[model samples]
Target: MARQNTVHAAAAVLVVVPTYNERENLATLAPRILAQGEQFHLLVVDDDSPDGTGPLADELAAADPRVRVLHRASKGGLGPAYIAGLTTGMKRGFDYLVTMDADHSHDPADLPRLLAATHDARADVALGSRWTAGGSTRGWPLRRRVLSRGGSAYVRLVLGVDLRDATAGFKCIRASALAALEIDTIGSSGYAFNIELNYRATLRGFRIVEVPIVFTERITGASKMSGRIVAEALLRVPALRTTSLRPLADVRPLADARPT
Candidate 1:
């Protein structure tokens, strides 16, 4: 753990937030994340949010050098947006990269704890887990809670990964670990992407740690969850379990990208 601390003491961190019609949330979340400290940078990847979220992101980036935005042509999916952002972060030489919900569901205040876990545990990835000890959720309906918990359990059983919250979205990953994944080839584009990435990291022998956090349901915008997204996840879990890890050299180089 001490080794990690020393290695990343002055490391640059990029928090990649994928957004879709989250203008209201970003109005507040962006400032809060920037306030975390100078060591962290914020990247908002907007999937052509029709609600003018992409323009808002540009305004934020223009106002602060620490903030940047990535504009996509259409609403592809969460996984691809993150892959694009992570690839951008890696190419730009960031030492650590994080992914979290753009909505207020993920508290910006808890980011420090996740970063601390990354250093303290010497972990290649730190998951903000609601299922781990000291973790909890707020404002979620009973049915949603049940589904999330059940989903994690099923993923663990199917993937044989020991993680408590395989579907957790808030996480910090060492750039080295991310680069090792050959992220461009990742197939899952829904919630299952979280499980697939975690499982892949485990197979690559990287240390993964969980940090407890309270996940609150978003108060604004609409939830992206849908029947099709859930079904895609269920179908992808078995495919991930059977796929072999790709070699680093085989990973296609991602083009350099910037805020649009």
Candidate 2:
């Protein structure tokens, strides 16, 4: 379903980018995203970066009516920041909600493809995968590559999910899926949070399709991956397995979920 230019759709798509000390990257990332299409909007969730990313985001938002900002008091975990941004998007009633990295890792150019993939398949979730067919990562060292691909494999193995890139951070999820997820109840953070969302989507009978994307490593800033985050992911994966995740009933179809 790829196209020459951006795939035009009437439904509002909110791209929620979580930022912390990403001032340099955010300055360049915003315009490229807003250029994709008029229907595509951006919500920058800033975690009170010492580098003044919050103010920069405010500047961008002030310049463009489509851009909006949500400022948090401190640097919370990635999962919570995303939850806050996505929760805001949901409350504002966006038809599609996207989770993208701000470090220039997830290409702004791929935004249209993701939107098209989800739209054409009528999927509730569009996973911008690095392990799926035609998907790959760039500017990554062998060790980092091993960790990322291996982590995805491990999550699939332990969770019994068919997702190829289970630990992937870039995704487009419909608000209907978010509503079923019960935004306030989800607590998983970082890579584990991505895994949990995809897992829950499957349980809720949401059709999730993987779209190929070349994930480039960020050159402007330091990596956020820590031993503590890794350990947390290891511990949380199993807890999700043991815990009861009762599927929601009386579920609506894709057509019904779309905004009129």
Per-model TM-score versus the true fold: 0.90, 0.91
lDDT of each: 0.83, 0.82
Show pairs that collide, candidate 2.
none
lDDT of 1 by residue, 25-104 (tens): 99999998877766679999999999999999999999999999999999999999999999999999998899999888
Residues 163-231, candidate 2: write the lDDT tens digits. Answer: 778887898887888888875677787767787777788777777777878999898988888999999
Error of 2 at 184 (Å): 1.7
Pull out the clashing pairs in model 1. none
Worst 10 residues of 2 by lDDT: 248-257
Error of 2 at 21 (Å): 0.3
Error of 1 at 109 (Å): 1.1
